[model samples]
Target: MDVLAVSIFVFFFLLVTILGFAAARWRRADNLDNLDEWGLGGRGFGTFIAWFLIGGDLYTAYTFIAVPATLYAGSVVGFFAVPYTIVVYPIIFLFLPRLWSVSHRHGYVTPADFVQGRYDSKPLALAVAVTGILATMPYIALQLVGIEVVLQVMGIGVDEGSWLVGHLPLFVAFGVLAAYTYSSGLRAPALIAFVKDILIYTVIIVAVIYLPAQLGGWDAIFSAAQGSFDAFNTENADAIAAGEVGAKGSIPPAAAHWAYASLAFGSALALFMYPHSVTGVLSTRSRSVIRRNAALLPAYSFLLGLLALLGFVAIAAGVTVAGDPPNPQLAVPQLFENEFPSWFAGVAFAAIAIGALVPAAIMSIAAANLWTRNIYKAFINQDATPKQEASQAKIVSLVVKFGALVFVLALSKSFAINLQLLGGLWVLQTLPAIVLGLYTRWFHRWALFGGWAVGMGWGTWLAYGVSSPTQAHFGGPLVPFPGTETNVYIGVVALLANLVVTVVLTVVLRAMGVDEGTDQTQESDYRADAGDEGVEEELDLTAPAHG
Candidate 1:
């Protein structure tokens, strides 16, 4: 073990741990036994705090590890992340403020809570809640995967022995995370996000500037990466032709244009659909805060682009991994180790590990809120008190984190990754029920439910049938469009089918004079801000859900 690096890492880890617990007092509330206080930091975060918190939530450790890894591994489409992030901000700027207004107006803690109020269909609300939980699990597991990668790179836990011995450090780290998250709730991550974003920005900015100078500049880095890819392609010409290996390139080929665009567009649509993203949006102080952050958050997209270029820097620097096929996930961490001093490398590692912590905490909190509001309160106890609901959410947060830890430890890392991909596809299916419901009630509640079912089934089927050079099934995100050679994101295809089914079924249901459930929301609700008549600065447990 590198003692200097490990010591610095431990220092930062301990610092964040203290902050995580101390956060409960940062924005201290009289009663912490409520969803608004625990699950959303009292719904009072301003523009500055929300910027870091949401950035930390959306641009996760997995993005830090996986995006660069994809570029380092020569996946041309991996850069789609930059564009998708850019696209999402505009979309969110338009719609997310409305969600914030409505959520704040109704005291909706989760997207499913909004859905229930909008459609008045328990089954539809339950479907969204279940999907959020399922989609969020693999996502949390991937964050652990990010932590595991950094730990391995730091030489902290690579022993060849019993699983427990190898993963002991990971277990310790996870324990600290679960403890603070359970204790402080959303405040833990919202506070820790300040450190996480600073470190990430410091690390990425330094790496992009310092490493490119060391590698002779961007031109040389690109040339070196391209030459490396050309050499590999020549050597594996037979395998490439036989479809046993993929061709490497800095740019997508003609056939991949649709794939690139579709992935970007599809992911942009799916980004805010995740419970964690909605949780971040709703936690802000007002609709204006949400809109302001939308403009500010794209700064992260610029950072992400710079970070993705590090993959080329890694190639140019000749960073290598120790696996038969060579794991690309090690490229960024190994780059730091080989290129930076021991102390700074430790700081970088801490950034990654803490990056994992912020998102994991928020994800668990969001999933817990989903369970407490949409599942436990909706079904188990119709008249649950705020304290009872908060109690359930706090407990469920721990359970969610533990389940994710088990998921990462007990399963293959590749399996965890595959499931994360499916998670995006699954979560995107809920867009109609949530986003559409925000604007128009033209969609029949049962039709939205049917659409969700169709999208979920079709998207899973498409993802399952995908194949790559390394794996036979569920290997990648892009698949051939129906009756066309062009490849597109499976989520897009599934969403199209979902819209078709929803539209046709809505007309049929309306023509048959089906009973559309009562909408508990009003036009003014979508425009309400903080201090509006019905929007309380503090949640009143005794207040009726709807007036």
Candidate 2:
């Protein structure tokens, strides 16, 4: 029976994949071969499409599985995901258009390309590319994590001995995604986001409304959640409040408090800095497309709010997944199967499954762009043509998906999730270099590299010291260097230290007469426009892009 339900879900997912491949043709662009069309869906997504594409890409399938699971674990800190998302818009409003302007003016595809052309530092560009790709793999892995949980709860391979062999369902699932993403490039994922978001928004809205009716109301829901927390007092009490502990790990009070703040603040700041998110922003047609989408996309933030509340709904419905080997990631899926009708539950499953495809596709394209522009062209084959670059990226996209699959199947689910979190720490290290450098080149190229090294090393060591598997791989919050009692988000703590080192070293290096590389970019470059701008546009959309 569950096999039948999963079959229905996959059926719709494949239909969307086919549509995805056809998007380059749909958005008939004159320059399909360039980075604009292939890397960014042609950079002409108006507010309507940009709204769905960016929102779908940002609030992903992992958010579906992970947030409610966090609530189930009795941690108030997990709720921080809600506020952090809301805060991301205003912060992006400040920086993104400026970046779009500069990127558009200079014909920069990856942020690393901008760093290279701006500061004329190959090492700096290499650093950004490496950091972006490594940080992105775990993130891409988490998307598989989300879909795998959905398939598991649906009983796709119920009689299997372990999670690994049981994953035959996701094998077909991700294979379809890889093919479509490879064939269509950015256009595939951008087009499929419309279907994915519709499903996600539908499932979340219906569940938030219907689950309370089943649970007697919001009061019953919170009461059950609170009761569960009280029962876990001896073990999880302190850790829950601070959002400091991972899953159900042991930690001190002060550590958790700092950890919660660090995760929330740093994550908020770093959210838009992600290459995939940047790819979405840079793909828009006009400056207004980016700004309008920024304002309109808060609708998804509201959806995130509703999604967060489902954790309480799961508790109120008295819907405990019965198996002793139950995956905690199944909390939401199990809740839906128990609460919703089979048909609606099937739709909800489609929502989550399609939800996985949106970000996964976008992330893959973004990574491919980075690899093509930064490494493949920079070192391996400097004279590779546009077609050759695109071909190389297509091959790498397959390898990247399989790499994530290996992580998901070979490692514990908990470990995979932790690697994703560590990836967040890794990506955040780019802030001082990529995001900050956009506004000013005051930080010397050498200082930027120095700060990045220190930050990445410190962040990596912090992730290593924290146990990866026990908390399902989202290692506990970072500890202060000298005082392990005070914890923080590795991204925030390391980024701050990175900046401090950069500023101090910039001053010293300047005092000692170090040469700061010349920036080819101008101030007005950050304020460039689309139509009347002094830049050559890449993709002239004669029609919508499709594979």
The number of the candidate with the highest TM-score is: 1
The lDDT for every candidate, in the order shown, is: 0.92, 0.80
The TM-scores of all predictions, comma-separated, are 0.97, 0.92
Residue pairs of candidate 1 with colliding backbone atoms? none
- Poorest 10 consecutive residues by lDDT, candidate 1: 538-547
Which predicted model would earn the best lDDT? 1
Give the worst 10-residue stretch by lDDT in candidate 2: 244-253
| Candidate 1 RMSD to the real structure | 2.9
Estimate, for each residue in 5-100, the C-alpha lDDT of model 2 and write its tens digit. 666776787779778877757677665566777788777777788888899899989998888777766665767788788888888887888889
Segments in model 2 whose C-alpha atoms lie over 4 Å from true places: 158-165, 234-257, 322-326, 467-474, 481-485, 536-547
Q: TM-score for candidate 2, please give it.
A: 0.92
Q: Candidate 1's residue-wise lDDT over 365-384, tens digit each?
A: 99999999999999899899
